[model samples]
Target: MARTASLSGFPEWLPQERVVEQHVLDTLRRVFELHGFGSIETRAVETVGQLLRKGEIDKEVYGLSRLQDDDDSAAKSDPNALALHFDLTVPFARYVVENAGYLAFPFRRYQMQKVWRGERPQEGRAREFTQADIDVVGDGELPFRYDVEIVLVIAEALSALPIPEFRLRVNNRKLSEGFYRGIGLEDTAGVLRSIDKLEKIGAEKVAELLRTELGATQEQAEAALKLATIQTTDTSFVEQVRALGVEHPLLEEGLTELEQVVAAASSRAPGKVVADLSIARGLDYYTGTVVETVLVGHEQLGSICSGGRYESLASKGSKTFPGVGLSIGVTRLVSRILSQEFATASRSVPTAVLVTLNDEDSWSAAQDVAAQLRARGISTEVAAKADKFGKQIKFADRRGIPFVWFTDAEGAHQVKDIRSGEQVAADPAVWTPAEEDLRPQVIARVAAEV
Candidate 1:
């Protein structure tokens, strides 16, 4: 069982629980590498100015400062104030800009690291959590194909994990902004922000906000609401949006891009991708295709994965880096998996074999046997104390250690399967556990439960 955190939102998993988390991280890393995304890690802290460049996330940024300062240091305001990064994308954009000279154009990279967010704690929301992100950034301009490719790559990664059914709902900012402009709404960003809250506040409340806050007419608000309601699993959403009688060059451009994404996804990932016009990623930096994913039957938990395209997030004077990316909320997904009993580790401990000490003086002999097993690629641990034979066996059993090694007075060796009461004479130099028993296994729960 996992222990409850003394401080809410900061999750600390127990050893067995950590096994599940590690398994998830390892799986993501393997899948990301297979897709040719090289791994990169940015520093935890970034200047306050750098972090705030992309969005109005000052409330979520955890600023850093000294606990004690000398008189001279306190007299002057620090020009470079720092804060823990709230997300990987902004920092990655900065990294690209800073390293533009050394990096090749159209760089592909994957980052898995902890990010701090100062938000209210909830079941799926954490103050600090791990995010697994993959992005392709290019110099000057990036291809539209990358937007579609990101969706497929993330779908493949999520499908590899033992999770419930998920849907990658996608949209394009150009489509949304153009639709708003088509209806004579000038504050497209303000309108997008309001429509983004449709799920949380509902259509009626969102329409009210658009009218009262953004000075939008009821007809304009209604048109935006109608656009937000359009959703489909294929390119059919193109007609659904067109049915609203809205037209703009940007809207048409967005429609073509989103259509390509959904059409390709239909053949590649099938039902995993959908054209969800309401997916307005609240972040201002996302300039094109935006995506938000939810686990089916657990939509209340919110997006387990999300990201979008950015045209100007990274730039140096005249050079601009356009990119498409996606990020998986690793901690949130793992927490849900464990709480719902979606999967479990086979053993709490990694040791495959526990070599028992015959006596206090036989410790050296037990070590030799353990070394032999270790050299053969088996995880072996010598008993800590020369307890009675039964006691040592009980210790191994309690830890879920399947095999226990025993040494006789004459140095003959025997191994016992604790779960099954079977003992066999074996050579430490050649004996090997079943392949499945070599390491901890992540066993998914039954289909019905999942």
Candidate 2:
């Protein structure tokens, strides 16, 4: 039998769930804008060469090809006759390069957009998902202090969201690079990538892959695994690793800077950020600091926030772009929140006061009440159906609408708080709801993420 066709690659939810998603996005925007980052959006596709600059991301691209170009031979054609973007960072780099003249140095911007990947979707992975990204691109040579700002803003943004428990894991590429080279391994990135899979692949097999495929001696592989597994709730882990007598100078510098970021963020939200040496952001490009955030109880879902510093991501007119930034995986974070039923939101329609239409003759009176409330900046909606008064109340109740306004034959208006099932006579022109009553809310989550 032919089954129902479900939407492929794309996922959506009910209105209340969407409200949660919107709240998360809005909080991100508020934080980014407060930090003086401008906003921008880039086109979704780039040429094949542009997309494959690093080669590692090519597998994730859902490539686009012209119908004519692929009609004769689909197998051998370059995918970018039109390709869906795999991530936003590449496009932003291209955007800055393309608009080099108009853009200012240290270009600060926030982007929220959907990116697609051709992957076998599972519990937390999605083929089509949204990412909220913020980056600062200077003409060249970004001050490392901006790395401090990136972590601060990301920690602030996630703190504003209604999530119970999350911690931003911090690391430095220079530390990893120097340490790997110090240990005499040339393919450090390959080793870092393998270490990234540590959470997915247990230590035993990872040790084997490191020694065999990554070409690490057994002792070197074991040390790398130990470094990857050494996670802590604070910066002391860096010192713990250093106690083993590692001799890389950059490792010392990485630890010092990571301590500064933790101290900065802890002033606002204590214990919400941590320095972990294992968080080698899988991408090879990150040149300085890196981050990976995991929810406390839902740690298995993995990092919901990730990005890092790339000092030379763009090139134009003899100036290379040096940038520091972070990307919040909107889809992944929202999905985790949804799966555990961890969020609450007001109705999506936002009709705070639904004016009742008692009958056809009195409909205009209800409309007047609605208009008056709306004029006062209250969200008001006139009941569409001239049904029974009981049915009208039921409609408002079904929507979780807080207040129901009724107009009697005498042209007097009354308001009811649906939650309390209480009503009172009030003048729409003179009476105002309490400020907190008007605002939408997510259930107060744990102030200190669990």
Candidate 3:
């Protein structure tokens, strides 16, 4: 047998991880649907040109080709091959443009899909990652109300997760851009790129790089760095900066908007959001209301959610299509949560009740029990193997099946809860398991002594 090397950048999770992943996805879909965001999926391919125009030159984009083109290398380079979609937004923009004529105005759509990136894979960053995105776009112009709605919806979605504490630190691109311009910084993009590395490279290193690499003046570099590092718990941070005599109208306006967003977001999702000036989301396309959510103690996981408003991103002309959005990196969040034991599965199998198939002759009784229980909204599966009672119980226990139904000539079913080692004989139509046992009770069970 030949050995195969583990593919780089592509990661597959264990069974437990898969359970966590599904949980995260299910929660995201529920929130997205609750807020009227319909689901749409785009193919995992785009032209190299569209991807390049999207941004980030260094991103590793794996080109596609048919095996037929393997012989002719030039054939692989033909225009027919499509690049994997980098993020949901770019492909979504192209989707809206193509579907504009038939689609309704103010298109609110939520997408859950994997995106490929040609970057170094470490920790949260991966060659392939899953992102749960919700974006609102109109035919030509996007409304400001949708911007707040997008941010607010994402915050609510994340709050549903089992994380201890997190803050959705949001800032407007206009505020940052206007501040950059008013403070006499010529290259706002360049300054933002440096500020984005504030977490990675630290403030001192970022300031030095800004001055040396970006040709920023010492004072300008320091001010920008301070803004990137500056964080506040509430709108009070706005007044804190104002007291600094920042003396920039754009900065003042940014502070004002921050105040409004905090008040508004807090009114709805109180204490779930905050205004942090340092949230310079290191992206070129983001034009306003940048956001980066951070879990209190696990700030090391970095921003679990991030995105911002972009102006005229989908148009051929400069007609503003200003919209704001944030993506919950499901893969990243799930990985951290599972790795850190943040969420525990209730059961291994999706089934709550297991019906034992005693034998081929009596299998009908077990099948009948399954049908009756299922009709009652109980997830019951007939044991594929008609093994002994001990073996059947072992199978259920191994998979963390909470309740097992045992049939007898009494023409009835009995229920057993695995955890407490309790068994009760009753009618399959009337008996009920606790809420924890109703669904897949997946979790890491404590190891028994050998």
Return the TM-score for each candidate structure: 0.97, 0.90, 0.88
lDDT tens digits by residue: candidate 1, 238-328: 9999988899999999999999999999999999999999989899999999999999999999999999999999988888999999999
Cα deviation at 423, candidate 2, in Å, is 2.6
Question: Which of the two, 1 or 2, has more lDDT?
Answer: 1
The models' CA-based lDDT, in order, is 0.91, 0.79, 0.75
- Expressed as tens digits, the lDDT of each residue in 194-225 for candidate 3 is 77787787888988988898787888887776
| TM-score winner | 1
TM-score of 2: 0.90
The positional error of residue 149 in candidate 2, measured at the CA in angstroms, is 1.6
* Superposed model 1: Cα runs more than 4 Å off: 69-79, 446-450
Better of 2 and 3 by lDDT: 2
**lDDT of model number 3:** 0.75
The C-alpha RMSD in Å for every predicted model, in order, reads: 2.1, 3.4, 4.6
Question: By how many angstroms RMSD does model 3 differ from the true structure?
Answer: 4.6
